[model samples]
Target chain A: MTARGGIDLGGTKIQAVVVGEDHEVLGQARRPTPTTGGPQDVADAMAGALGDAAEAAGVRTKALGGVGAGSPGIVDAGAGTVSGARNLPGWEGTFALGDALSRALGCRVALGNDVQVATDAEFALGVGRAYHSLLGVFWGTGVGGGIVLNDEPWLGRGAAGEIGHVVIERDGLRCPCGRRGCMEAYAGRGALEIRARKLEAKGEKTKLFKLMEEHDRPRLTSGIWARALDQGDKLATSLIDEAIAALGVGVASVVNVLDVEAVVLGGGMGVRFGEPFADRIREAMAPHLFSSDNPPVFEIAALGDLGGAIGAAMLVA
Target chain B: MTARGGIDLGGTKIQAVVVGEDHEVLGQARRPTPTTGGPQDVADAMAGALGDAAEAAGVRTKALGGVGAGSPGIVDAGAGTVSGARNLPGWEGTFALGDALSRALGCRVALGNDVQVATDAEFALGVGRAYHSLLGVFWGTGVGGGIVLNDEPWLGRGAAGEIGHVVIERDGLRCPCGRRGCMEAYAGRGALEIRARKLEAKGEKTKLFKLMEEHDRPRLTSGIWARALDQGDKLATSLIDEAIAALGVGVASVVNVLDVEAVVLGGGMGVRFGEPFADRIREAMAPHLFSSDNPPVFEIAALGDLGGAIGAAMLVA
Candidate 1:
């Protein structure tokens, strides 16, 4: 029985998993991402994680069929390098991640961006299983998305499906990408925090700041936001509403142009909010649809944290 | 020699052409559209136009291998019927246009929407020939567009490439399609004329009214607008600028999402303004592009008036 190795290399954490031919996870390992050691150090951590995962699965690294990794930022898949990943400190410029991983594991390796890999996973074995065309949106620190067309990922001119960068407002909020009015600038978790801070400064009644202070965290996590919403926090609710509306505009444009059959929501924020958030997005997107009578199906992603790893493995499967 | 028949059925005119396998025009005919006689009358006119074209080519209708027609409105290509064609009176609901034309011409028939067929023509033999992925935008009475991905038309779900309906402004201008903030609401010829009339009623100095009166036309034509712009009409220039800006936002969103290799501008307004309009669009779209450094090539569409006919023929070829 052949086994495949997969890694989801994120900003704060690196998750590695070994899966068999049936898509069942044979073994898994997790570790804090090394930010101080630069790209080489991060690559070494990935190698170690893969080794541990393979050992736990009772398989030799050299015996694995292939390995795949999903990272953050603009990835040149052909060159096997990642660039423009701002969240991963010391992880800039072109890094031959695939080559390094392949050398460490002694097998062929493939690479893709996190959102793209997650989308591929959803399309293959999750909520998007029934649709040939789909748009997968993941709301986390930044709102990112990927598109699958005719059972293949539509990577136009190297960098397609920048749904977060789609400008919803002409001259609205400033995005981290140096663009104004991008969907990310409005719907990202960072955006929500900014709004929360502003509303607190204005003396508006809210439990978000108090909760954050109690936890002693600089940024509110998806779990905290969910808890606040469940507790009926006014500021949190309003921020979520704003995010939903902005997300709706961007998603509606994608749906109207691509005419995809399904839109799957994933990532920390998306899965945390769950059905309520999906419903809001569907309702807000209805008015903007060109074909309002026949809109795409909106659903929450099903793969959970294993989506990126599963999707990455499938890249070489 | 084998020849194929093509027809462009518009609201005011019916154009038919016979072309050889090499895409050379063998024969062509044009006639005023029959509006009073209903869908059946329009079908008869299409048959008559094809007969005339085939006779001029000195070929029997039965000898032609295939015939294709491009019509206005929502077309069910599989069923060969057209619906929601508001321009053609009594052409609502569904008409079996392909069967009607096939019965009359004694050959297999194909059907597509006007914009989709025109885009196919441009992609296959015109400005978009060099690009594998393309977005073809046609500015006329309404702003309609078509997308070609991997050298094939992307008819998503049922109706894809509805770029005009992509909402740019939140609750902006009211669109004829009962939507707000659509690109067509601000950039279509009908939208431009509506703006002109409103400005004129506000006592603004403009050459649009003068040009319309001089030509004895109720509505301003593309040529009239072009001449007015050349003659230094402030109103016309401003309107064109506004239209270009709105078009840029909508187009930039598409480019940001799809990352097509090229964007070909065509139809009455696009051709009339030519390079100047294309330049303005490029400039306005730059700021909104996610990949601004490597933007898609913007070009004015070639193929002139025969684009629809040529594209239709290619559908069957």
Candidate 2:
């Protein structure tokens, strides 16, 4: 079984893995994403992460057959470029990310959208394996989504499955994408953090920021939220309630349109909150559902944090 | 050339068509749906309608290759049955509609969903021909949607494209389906009519009901709406404006999930108001769009009222 390398480029972390045939992880590494660098520096960090993984796997980086990476942005898979990844610092225009990675690692590099790869991994070898059609809802920095229809990815015009932007209200709260009334405006981690800070500035009593500071997190990380929930932070619970309501509307609305057999929830919050949160989202979806009698079942994505990197590795496979 | 018969069963009327090998309509007929009868009588009317069209085409109904039909409800295409068609009078349980029509007409029968067939027709020979992926939004008594992805219908779990049920608000207006804040709650003709009557009872001024009475229509049909708009009826225009706004959010929301290449607007309201209404909906969709830079284009369905029947005929073809 030949070894292949993979990378997952997120707003907070760069994850890398070296996998052998059958997708068993041979080695893995993780590094915090640079908060102040441009695309080139981000690309260098991704290369370094892969190199660390290759070293752990007892192989030279150049000895691996190829490497695959999942990155945020509007990806042109054919062109190996990423554009408009506003979540990354100074990632303004298109960058040949694949080429850059390949130059540093001495092999071909395949590029995919971050969430799409994670969804693909879940569909291929995780919770979505039993279903013919599945919608992978990854609730994280921005509530991203990916679709698999009839056992194939349905990337309509190359940009399908943008569920976070579904308008849950007409002209409501502003979204991170600059849109108003989007599901992400209410439910995305970035938006939630922004909302929390706004409320705190206006003298709203809350332990969310305090918890983040205690944990040394630059943002309201999922771990801090979990801690805040345990302490029964008023602001945290209230915002989480709103997020559940918005997610219910958004996810249920998608289920009504696609009617997939299953929904696999992933990403940061989805994994952290798990069964209880899924149950709440299900209860929320019940009212908005049109085909309530024959609704799709829900599952937490089974691959955990390494899903995107593993999926990218499979691109080489 | 060989001939085939097609039928479309609607809430108000039954439409039938006979087509040649080239799919050119050789004969057509229309009849009022029995507002009181069960599925058996409805099947009989469908048979009779096809007989008239076959006669007009100078062919015997039994001599045709086969006949196809588009009906509202959950269709079991393999079983040739329709179930829970609440739009039709007293159609509660499953009925072997294809078998009944086949027995009466002495030919094999094929069945499909009405909105789906209309969407298929548009994809095959109408406005959606140029599109690789399409979302057909048909706004009639109820807002219905049909989807085509990668040149095939995406009927996930047999009940996809229920776009009317997509929740647009958190616990907003109650829908006819007993849900709150559905797109159809605001945009459907039935909902709009209900809202208008409610407002009129509350002393809201408008000529909607007067125009409906003058036209001798039991319901506010599309023609009456066009006339009311021409007369600048405040109540009618206000309701229409709400519909446009709701359509914007609903359609944009669907586009966010699918990112389809095109959207084909059909059904009664969509056809009557045409391009101007489409433009208004487009403007409304702009703000809620996730992929604002590369949005799907919109168009009116080109097949008019006969689209469904023609689409059903193609099933036989």
**Residue B193: error of model 2 in Å?**
1.4
**What TM-score does chain B alone reach in each candidate, compared with the true chain B?**
0.86, 0.94
> Please, what are the lDDT tens digits per residue for candidate 2 over residues B1-317?
47999998876678899999888999999886776879999999999999999999999998999999999889998899999987777898999999999999999999999889999999999999898899999898789999999999988888899999888887889887788999999998878888989999999998999998998876777788889999999888889999999999999999999999999999878988999999999998988888888889899999888888899998889
**Deviating ranges (above 4 Å) for candidate 2:** B58-60
Residues B75-107 of candidate 1 have per-residue lDDT tens digits of 989988988776576876888988988998899
What are the per-residue Cα lDDT tens digits for candidate 1 across A1-317?
A: 59998998865467789999977899988776775757778888988998998999999888999999998878888999987776666765778888988888899899988889989999989998999999999887778788999999998987798888877777778887778888888788867787778878988888887787787655676777887898999888888888999998888988888999999998778887889788999998999998898999999999877787888888778
lDDT tens per residue, model 2, A1-317: 57999899987778899999888889999887887879999999999999999999999999998899998889888899999998788998999998999999999889999899999999999999999899999898889999999999988888899999998988789998998899999999889999999999999999998887888888887778888889999999999999999999999999999999999998888888989999999998888888888889898889888898999988888
Where does model 2 sit among the CAPRI classes?
Answer: high
Question: What DockQ does every candidate get?
Answer: 0.70, 0.88
Interface RMSD for candidate 2 relative to the native interface: 0.7
Task: Output candidate 1 Cα RMSD.
Answer: 3.4
